[model samples]
Target: MEQSNTTLPSETWANSSQSPAPMGAPYMAAAMLLFATFLVGLVGNGLYLWVLVMKMKRTVTTIWFLHLVSCSVLFTLLIPFFTVYILLGFHWVFGTGMCKVLSACTHLGMFSSAFLLALISLDRYTFTCHPIWSRRYRTMSWAQKLVAGVWLCSFALSVPYLVFQETSELESSRITCVDYYDTSRDQDRAETQAWRQHTHVVLFLVRFLLGFLLPFCIIAGCYSQMGLKMMEKGLARSGKPFKVMVAAVVSFFFGWLPYHLYYGLTLFKDLSKSLMGICQLICIAMFCFNVCFTPILYLFVGQTFHQVLRTSLFTLVKTAFYEDLDSDGVGPDSSGRIR
Candidate 1:
């Protein structure tokens, strides 16, 4: 989520910076969500990365998929930081550098994921509708270059967090990490507050537009064209492809919409804490869905899910029944069929 550097009145800050209360339902639930998501994301993305890197043959498709899984894996690595921060009652024991780095990394993960999804959608469209052009230009080198470009773009978008995020000591002597735009200590209070709000509004809009809206449109449009092309060619007669296209677009949109909206609502000074907490819970749920389930969707549709599933299942069954199949002299015939 994009950080909003809104400067509220001192009373609001005092209320927000009060000593950590007893762990409530919301805090417990959020911590659990982050923990569970961290575990699932680690295992799932790790397995997929292994398969992509070690088991599957390299291709442009695999290249795109490899980097996408890498993003999830890298992001999963950051979840514990959040889990700890939540468990600490929102106090940030991590140094200011870490606060900035974590904020930037979180946004980097989000932006890279969005950009990769959009890239994958466009790649699918090209391969489907312009096979000749794709054959000529869609090479491993080109894919790598494009993926590098995506990372660069994501980093560029996230640098503002590094500049704006810092640890602010609260009224209770506890430290909290927050985005703060006012750096000039000598500036007039009113001017500083105005500049902070202005920066917040500007970065908020920039983040939403570039991070969510633009990539979303690209994905939706590319998928739409692909669907139409498939229909014209009779490849979409089964309706499964159309359903997949719709699911891809819907999942990407809904998974990230709440994250942006939650931060957007934070711009309002009068928003209740309870409502914000609910919005945060929704954001966490959606974040988990995006990080964990999105990869499964990608694998199911584009990564040869059946083949991988069958192979893994067969290996597991064979390992479990090794003696039964081999010791009884009933393993296989000369033709290699199971006896």
Candidate 2:
């Protein structure tokens, strides 16, 4: 949530020259979008969590999905503070510990969510492509172990962010949590920038390949083969769930791709200031959108959507109208005889 003093030249020029358009407009718009996204993510993911835990019977798939929704919910929870910070011109009033916690939570949730999706894709692949072996080995115990492994791996991967993030007083005397590096001891700031360049490149490549590209390719291939098999077998009678699953995969890729691409492209120096700002905005928007959309995709993709909805509605009506009725009597008061 910290605003760096290193403003792009275009931003400085706009603030100095552009009198017709208010400088805070973009910030306000971004804040509003983030807040709206947060609300949708919170409500949508909350519903998914509730249905998974309370309405749907426990199953391997539902258990995995429950973990996915929970991570997304945690991701969305960080948005309000971010929204408020942007609205307040990117001030960090939340203290250093919270800053680190929030930053780490965001990264952890992202990595964990991606890992879960990859896990789900792999599960589906095994279920569809290697049914016999999968049947022999794909128990709930295996799923639980995989989930635990994912959490541990994700936590380990995010340790660098937790280590590097710290609060410091900038030249403006404003306290902000930033990723600080000791480059002053080097010959010049350019050397530090060069080191950052290399680090960013490596990190971006690794993240893009592991987090985005590999998972997407696996998902795309698995779903493609599944669809082909279903079509060939004439088992497309239950096509809705298949279509929903495909849509979910497609949305997942499209939603996160722009963000990752922008993140990677930021390592290069060819992008203009306005373009960089736009990219940043797009990345932020996409990140928020992804957190909000995953649970919705799960809601619609799973075959249990209608079943869960019907059960919930039925439960609500029964609770509202019949909970107070005497079970022993169970007879009409005046129009019918008690039996």
| TM per prediction | 0.80, 0.76
lDDT of 1 at 30: 69
| Candidate 1 all-Cα RMSD | 8.5
Tens-digit lDDT track for model 2 on 248-288? Answer: 56656766677676655555556676776676566566666
- What's the count of clashing pairs in each model shown? 0, 0
In candidate 2, stretches whose alpha carbon ends up further than 4 angstroms from where it belongs are: 1-23, 181-193, 237-244, 300-339
Candidate 2, position 204, lDDT: 56
lDDT of all predictions? 0.65, 0.57
Residue 143 lDDT (model 1): 87
lDDT of 1 by residue, 74-123 (tens): 77787787677667777778898987787787778777777887897888
